[model samples]
Target chain A: MNEEIVRLEDAWVHFDGVSVLEEVDLSINQYDFLGIIGPNGGGKTTLLKVILGLLKPSRGKVTVFGHTPEKGRKFVGYVPQYSLFDRDFPVSIWDVVLMGRLEHKKRFKRFSEEDKKLAYDALETVEMLDFKDAQIGKLSGGQQQRVFIARALVAEPKLLLLDEPMASVDSPMQTELYELFEKLRQRMAIVLVSHDISAVSIYVDKIACLNRRLFYHDSKELTAEDLEATYQCPVEIIAHGVPHRVLKEHK
Target chain B: MIEILQYEFMRNALIAALLASIACGIIGVYVVVKRIVFISGGIAHAAFGGIGLGYFLGVNPVLGVIPFSIAAALSMGIIGRRTKIPEDTAIGILWVMGMALGVIFVALSPGYAPELFGYLFGSILTVPTSDIILMLSLNAAIIAVVFSLHREFQAISFDEEYATTIGLPTERLYLLLLCLIALTVVLLIRVVGVILVIALLTIPAAISRQFTHRLSSMMFLSVFLCAILTICGLWLSYAFDLPSGATIVLVSGTAFILSTVSKSIHISVFSKSI
Candidate 1:
């Protein structure tokens, strides 16, 4: 029932001699929903990129399904952070979502009927099937996230990686997405990086606190000391700033 | 217009316009969407070096542009992506360096470059059969490359990082796209001249973008628009005794202004069906 999907060993990343990740080691298994919580600029996005092989770590090793990051990334679906691209880009939701099946298809070959069906079903799963013909840029922010999520799901990935998935989504939409993730986790391992601790505590089976380093546990409860170490701040401020339910278990 | 078809120069000019339009119509979409107009302009200006190299070597300058501009394109693509030097800054330097080299190469040649102005501002009416053949070949190459690899091009233009994550060799594809742009610049040189090549490259795609949401439609419409505008400009220049390249650019400019103004006034009369 338990098989390892991702493993990072003694990973250290430095950008121009400035350390972004320090001695971060993590292991994710099948059916695991691991949430990484951290402060702004806490290297959460960097960690995800390293896993995707987009950013090569300065030191240490990372393996996905026991293969190199680049080769194994075909089985990993990624939903990047909210809104880094041009909103005025001239691409339709259907075309953008269909790109998810590209790695599965041969170079220069057309998308097959099954590929279209999977993309359609993925859009339907995210309730964005109605906007298939609409330009991706014409949609609102939350709508765009759903489209990207649908793209991630269309590939039938063994591992799903999302960065800042909840950043700009509204409250109701956030709950919908969390529920969507809950359903998705049974089929694939899910790893989401967010600064929000409350949702992680509530939804994820395991939680990790990351600043420059990583500290995680099997249970959702993160000790106050872990939050302090990650945030480089006091527990009192976290209790005040975060939802009361988040720190209740810690206290 | 019917009588003009009998004249070989007129016929050649018209064919050149169609060929040039096809090249721009396809490559221009990537240029506009990727917002790499400056680098394109650099590639165009850098072809002047190739033009100069042709004069100095006593070969057809258009032929010289093939290798020269490809080199320019590869350099711009690689240096911009691989090195820390800012892309625009690199383009600026290369753009002027090529132009300077062109001047020097022509100066060193034995005789006066009689048709240099034609290459500068364009005299499409004087386009020879040899150059037309070259243009035809270049256009074919451009079409073949784009026809097969446009999906990858679209992927990079829409989101380069995402393209990389999905395991596309984004850097290599980008360089190939630049090479296509270089080839397009070669075809366009005869129709619009080096000075005005960027206009022909941009205006058609920019106009077509207003009315379409899909990439394929945008490309198709863009090619159609390029052909119409270039022919109109050529006719106007022929009838009124004006410089053909400048005339074509101005006509495209006017069409753009008109299209934008009409759309803004709630005329949305033309449905975006395409």
Candidate 2:
């Protein structure tokens, strides 16, 4: 085993006496690009929250890098869904990205040159270097998501979790984002919760179908039978490389 | 003016203005940025219960208000986070209940207390030396906390969910921020009174935010604006024999309106020229 980075054993989660996740067991290796796909109200987002230590599982255990989820949070970076930011807030993209360095520095100490360089480097990775001085709210939806990714990358974490990173983006931007994710996959383990199942299936190393339980699939050899079983509905799996599509078969 | 300074009360009032302006400016930045102006107002009004309790128990009003205000702040944070009730509704309920409790306590107290009026409408001219010292110390503490947690506070304000995933204890930070707000409200109650403290806390910061993009610059500009307004209001009150709290609020309110008007004009003219 290539040193599992994340291990969840029989993880169970309940909200308001209703089980959101039941007996979910998963293990992610280092540098694994994992895609979690399901319909709305499925437990995909909840699973990411559990891995990020934002929500504790009701039963079972979750370990990341041989430590508890809470202790391992410093090694995890997160990009949340679209936020409703006030347009009048007076903060620049540079200031927002530098906030990622707070956990590494002392409370009273000023940020060092190393921290500034890291923030700039992260922004450059997302191709947002020119807009570093711009106010965050002035950016478009795609640009704001990129800036959020930059903020997460500034922390230099081993694992990155993204919740619906491409929901509001246009088609070209979505393609560009997937390309960026391809480049990011080389250095960090990525767990993305996306509604675009066919598009993500082309790039992800593995896929997990979550709708109250785990339905694992190997992306390299995904079959129509697996698709139907995972979705609990008849699905015709068409074999095209990029921008793949899934159609339901009529009886 | 020199003769006014010769009086102990005038000197104390000046010191109160200096300290309270700095404290309010710093806390005001967070209040404005967080969009919690009404919540801070609710806290200030709720602090009246503390004052009434102090009078009823024959204790220092400042000491008495601390616990009551902190309790109210905690409840605000808890109910606002955990319940489906809108935050504004909760704030309204707490604000009215606090004042009613204060009135009931005062009416039922052993003897009629005349000092309650000063607490209600403010008496800058009656500020004592000890209260001035307390205000100065509180201002220092508020400045220290804000500066030390500048980055974390920014992160939390921007995206609290992302902050938590990156290992920042956002809930604890939020609670700490509410506590700081409560402390600032208590420190400022003497200068502007509870009724007018929210104006002093929000107006200068809101105006300063229009001219700056950095948090530190906003803080500096707000403090300078507040200090100047406090001095100008005091002078006006002294010259015209007006209520100091109302004068101070009017001064800050005018500044807010002027800033808004200038901002609109600048945008329109620039757009036309372009």
Q: Give me the displacement of residue B16 in model 2, in angstroms.
A: 1.9
Runs of candidate 2 with Cα error greater than 4 angstroms are A198-201, A220-251, B1-8, B78-94
Per-model B-chain TM-score: 0.96, 0.95
TM-score of the B chain in model 1?
A: 0.96
Error of 2 at B199 (Å): 1.5
RMSD of 1: 2.9
Can you write out model 2's per-residue Cα lDDT over B44-85, one digit (the tens) per residue?
Answer: 999999888888888878877889888888788778877988
Taken over the whole model, the C-alpha lDDT of each candidate is 0.89, 0.83
Error of 1 at B72 (Å): 0.5
Q: Root-mean-square deviation of each candidate, in angstroms?
A: 2.9, 3.2
Worst 10 residues of 1 chain B by lDDT: B265-274
Write model 1 residue lDDT over B4-44, tens digit each, in one string.
Answer: 88999999999999989999999999999999999999999
Looking at candidate 1, what is the lDDT of residue B204? 91
